[model samples]
Target: MPFENEFASYEPLRRILDNEKVQQLQDRLKVRAIEHDDETISEEITEKSQVEPSEYQPDMVLAIDGSYQAVKVENGFPGAEIGYVTVASVLILLEKIRELEREEFIDPKQFRETEKAATIDAVFPGCNVIVDDEDSAKSSMRRILFDELKNHIVFSEGETLLDTYEALLKIKLEQKSTPSRCPHDNCDAEFTYDYGEYQCPACGGKLYSSDAMRLHELMNPVGSNGEMYGQIMQTLEKLWLIHILRAFEKKGWLMTLRRVAFMMDGPLAVFSTSSWLTKAIIIELHRLNELAKKFTKQDLILLGIEKTGTFVNHFEDLDTTKEGVADKFPKQAALLLHDEYIKKNIIFSESLKPYGKDTYFGRKFFYKTSLGYKIVPSVAFFNEYQQNLTTARPNQFTRLADVMSLLDQVVSSRYKNAVTPLVSAHAEASIPLNLGRRIFEDIAREIREQS
Candidate 1:
């Protein structure tokens, strides 16, 4: 009996490790590392690169991010879930009226601060609760999603942005072929829905329910309020702003993206949960870029930055090798940039790796703005850089050398490998350290009389 119990303990882990689903994960992945280069930085990295910076400058730099806190819903609705969220977006004008550049000999705390630093901001704060019924929960979640979008959508008297947005949403969902499958993971049989009552043929279960009996099964559907759904709320919030920006582009109100850069907190790769939204955005952007010549306009500038990466750690060594004759330690860095660097030093893999075979939504590159501090720059510049700016032809290389050209305006002395505009935006957007807990207390007191 002791032996039987001991064997059973090990079996669970072994089964989990060697399970068919687990094995499928390993088969789908491959690793890529930076081909170690033995060259040190002998000269300034800016000198050797062959590319020119655009003469244009952004009129504004806008940055957006969201924060959320989960709370307990204890009022009569038993199986109900509750959460609160705050999304902040900040705008910094690239072109400003003349202002004092600096206070002559300022205190350390306020020295780098400028009167023009912070500009317009959009902050979203709200709570969400899901009760026992599947349909009721869906309605609640959908209301939160659309309410946020409608509140944020910019408009004028004549042009209707909201109407256009709804049309786009319909097209996005229909084109992507939203999956219809049994809500039960174990009985995930596919089906077609005509917006009518249904039951799972395979399990003889309620496919669409208004009660707790179907809670677990209901979690598998696309819009279900489960773990993945919670994770996706942030992405959905982001896409709402993107859709609005694209709508503006269509109306010719913002004739030029060159005068603006949109900064997001992360990469452009859209995950499976929101692939439909991603597809629609990409398709629309492509169409606009194709007609760019006719409109005499430029493409959108979206920048996603990460402060750390595999190549970042590798740059600590800076590829040093002893030379012939003089044998002096050179300042030349390996600079594992977009082209050859992605082949070797990519850090993530499997499901979390860079989006597969599709050329990245934005090309990934690396830069060392300061010694020993490295960063991964995810910029959309490469997609349009294929030609020599005269002939329409693919450049032999990624031609990301010019990206660092704007570093002078983008970099900040306050943070390593970070742009100043983003830092300011993040500071303004962030919820205070304990504000979520305080807000939760306030809600508990108001709603349930206890905290």
Candidate 2:
């Protein structure tokens, strides 16, 4: 029979569906049921009303968010992919947020005056951009990243984003060299960096501060660079956060740093190949907080609020209740999960490897606002992987009271457990997914045809 006439040949589909062994296999899978009104759980939940208030209201909130898309062109001889990343930081006055909150209805005229913030976008080469030349894609991508990093004007006085990246690396990891290998094919020669800039002695290829991210390792001649795109977006988002804060400090604007709450779109963690940057970020955050404390007697209000992930699921489970049962996790409360709780409940691992030890710059806390929004906010800590840290641990929840205060004013019903600044940041950073991919594909096809 021809392949086109073989549609109904699979009799095993019915057998597989009727198999009792499949059901039994699922039954044997280990999955913890959500607990409601348990003693151990109750100890972790600290109601917001019970915690002491900071009386520290922020004047402004800066939310940073990013998005990335990769498009593959099927029409090309060897096929190709193009990736784009957009990152935006939006600054909105706290008074405006409060005004909007007080008034149940939003007014169109209230937004007549527009505000400008930082936006950084980049297009990257992926897959077989250069059909005949394999090394061209890798070399071109490296050059593009180098140009993008150093060329962007982050400060009015002529400081670039590359400068900020180098400064951060120097302050944090300059004492210890970061190791990496050359990206050139067949030349996996190892090297170390005391700082951001280094030239590969083996291949004589130039490296920039952006290379420290090691995103190039994810790039290849044939495979898609979609992963690299996401990694780059993340790295850029983090850099933007530090760049803006560094700018404020450079201009002697400690007051702005003190009264401003910088909201990040995701957890304060850098994962995958870029995870090494977490140490640098944690150290920098501490340095900045210390600087603000020295001048303003307060720490900088910076937080990463996650909308989705494993912790969000755990938080949702905690907030839920059976029909007759009382609430599992009370409203207006914050639960800081220790390593034991996380391992036993969330990650399903009793492994000795501490959770988020290598990747996380901050510790995660599940907080339910006074208005009943479940928020997973991660704040930078001096040492998140300390032994014997628990929910009742003191000094771990630094500026947490202020975070709760800020949450009360900016609740959003647009999405479940959403906040306004993040909503704004998302809108600013969002790209049209399907339409963007189609457009890029068409452009790629056209370029291929012309060439």
Candidate 3:
């Protein structure tokens, strides 16, 4: 009965209606309604922009991503958590889609016969972290997960699994100690663990990392949360790809690096505990590029393509914002979703947060493909974080300045916001239930054995 509960509360909703924050939002919404009313506002259509013929092209493109989820064992015990797993995958596009764009005419018959490519998928079987076995699972399963992920990793020449893992551990150590996750899975709270704090200030529970040297009882009992664990998996997946791609520099094969574009499945920026690793990656790429340019023909064509976000959700609904303006609103074509446009359209405005200014390792921008589908794309660059979020212009960029030629690398015809390679990669990387279930059975066994 202690672990069980019933929900029968509309009181919170009623209270929220009267809350100051809610009232302020209501006042703001009312003003927005008046300002953006169709009768009072002026609008115009935004014409499509043209993409120039390829100034540059990549012969191949690669994409990398991972799927992760955790499953709790309700039948096991009162307070027991269960299993977590991650499946990392990489997809390589060997065929060049840009070739079709360059060709004067596409003869369907010739196209079918002569040139076509599919994404080559390499799956990292899967890795499991035993969170709970319904009994006493004290085994260090996180290490096992990390180890297996490294073992199954695929990278280009000159990269090693051991080196990648050591790098990952270094990142884990570098994370800031304060403001960490709460000990309870349901409560995402952070407070001072300093000053001999024995329990989570938020839930009176505790949490921990899987450090063997420390006594488990001395540390917070609960381990990483779902979000943090997924991030850890993603961190490994990201580093694996970066290291592999970087090995090309050691190969000194400018021809391959030039013809190859790498598409990461998420935003160019790293988040959570993995941010340090991303920062290091940014620095390393700059260093490698500085040395490789003299030997290689062109800069690496790397991109991060995202299907959704705050910008994606709102902009997906609006092609152009022209309220109270002439026919001069910036078209949503490879432009930064500028602050002005954000104010004008007012699409999903309440959800927008004060931009946490991390100088992007990649330049973020929106692009409307030839097929008229809007997608966000980012190209890598060495940049620093901007801590102040109040500036009028938050460093929103239209497209990458230095990587102008790389824009040509995106192949747009059959697809909308996505390049052809990313689509294939996604297909390959998607974790089916059978292939990547949470390691519940393994977790249960481990806990039972330990008990």
Candidate 4:
């Protein structure tokens, strides 16, 4: 009876380790690791035999694209405008990798080959071959470049660049007599076709293919809601997953070699986005935590940075009820609640702090939270902009401060409204204020425990 009771006490941890779902996850991890090894060997042999010595160093880089299409502009600004921004973060073991010998860096390409091979092997294995004896290494590489690299490089058309790469690679593959075939179902067709159109003789199915379509498919596959809203949600979810993985890979490599610090440019959570998308992203992130433990054997710490002045001052000035305060607390509070919900659910790293307010040309006062950091807009930049026949500088500052100040107030007001008969009947369901507060407290507690 004592032994049984003790075993029952171990249930939670044991479920994490010994459950069937956990075993399946472990099996997938093992398979992935084996596949990664094979890919590593192939890449090492290929790079060592072909690539020049200079290219062998750890020059691998990751770039991400963040774009916002303004569907509706407030206060008589342009009705719609698409703002495109690209964020590129470099991950290099500058201190550690540089310490290797010149021979280690160049001669047999040991260092370069090892890292590249490991990345290739670990991220994706068995990607170079097809089931039917067709050598698809070039196409596989094209898919990777198109799906991962192009969109992140904002200046060029990702699809166009991928197309050019595929064409060049196809030429090389053709010279080696590798068979290129259509991937359509029930079609046993092979053609040394160029970059454009191919028609299947066996099934009459037209293949209008390009690297762009391939990338799109990766994000929004066929038979899985390709509507614009669906695509946007899918893209955001993919970005969230990729961001976590990339962060892990960055941190994992650093910790593997014993490094202390790392930095990120923006907040831990991606705010100014949709609520549904945010919730979906957080769900995927939770799943990623399980996946990361199985694959990398590391816990992810996503620390959000905030500025004390911004967080405290904004909350303080939410209402015009006080001197030096402005109105507009309602909408702002809603936005904060939305963001809080996201922060409560997603998991990330803890190595860096977030800045919440701008103090100088280059520096700012930063704050850290369980979710991530808060980044402030520069006064000078906002001052230069004109919106609704008024300088946006004052409005932006006032609105931001108001929103921060009124978060709790607005939430309280909303809670009262939810209880009101008219709204309660009209609205099928509403998130209670107490429940929201409890969620916030729970997240704070979890973060504190982890810290």
Maximum-lDDT candidate: 2
Candidate 2 runs further than 4 Å off: 1-24, 33-36, 72-77, 100-106, 112-116, 130-134, 171-173, 194-198, 323-328, 382-394, 431-451
lDDT for each residue of candidate 1 in 290-408, tens digit (9 for 90 to 100): 55424434445666666655544444345333343321222212232433234345544334233322324554444554333345566553344431122211131232333454444
Q: How much lDDT does candidate 4 score? A: 0.28
Candidate 4 structure quality by residue, lDDT tens digits, 125-224: 1222222232342234234333443333211212332343343335444445444455454566775434544555566644433432232223222122
Q: Relative to the true structure, how large is the alpha-carbon lDDT of every model? A: 0.44, 0.70, 0.46, 0.28
How far off is residue 29 in model 2, in Å?
2.8
Indicate the worst ten consecutive residues by lDDT in candidate 2.
Answer: 435-444
Model 3 per-residue lDDT tens digits across residues 1-451: 3345876578977998889998888877634333343332223222233333233455444566565554544543333443344433333333433455478887776554222122111221112223443112333333343345444433233445445544444444555444555434467787543321155677765332322112121222354345544554565556656656554544454444544566777777766644555555666666665565565544565678777666665445445444533222233335444333554453334445533234346655555544455667766653333212223122322124323333334444665456655655455445433343323233222222322
Predicted candidate 2 versus true structure: per-residue lDDT over 185-300, tens digit per residue: 67788876544556788987666666777787788667777788988899888887877667667756655456667788888888877787777877777777778777767667
Q: Which candidate ranks first by TM-score, i.e. highest?
A: 2
User: Candidate 3 overall Cα lDDT vs. reference?
Assistant: 0.46
Candidate 4 lowest-lDDT run of ten: 116-125
- Residue 128, candidate 2: how far off, in angstroms? 1.3
The superposed Cα distance between candidate 2 and the true structure at residue 181, in angstroms, equals 2.2
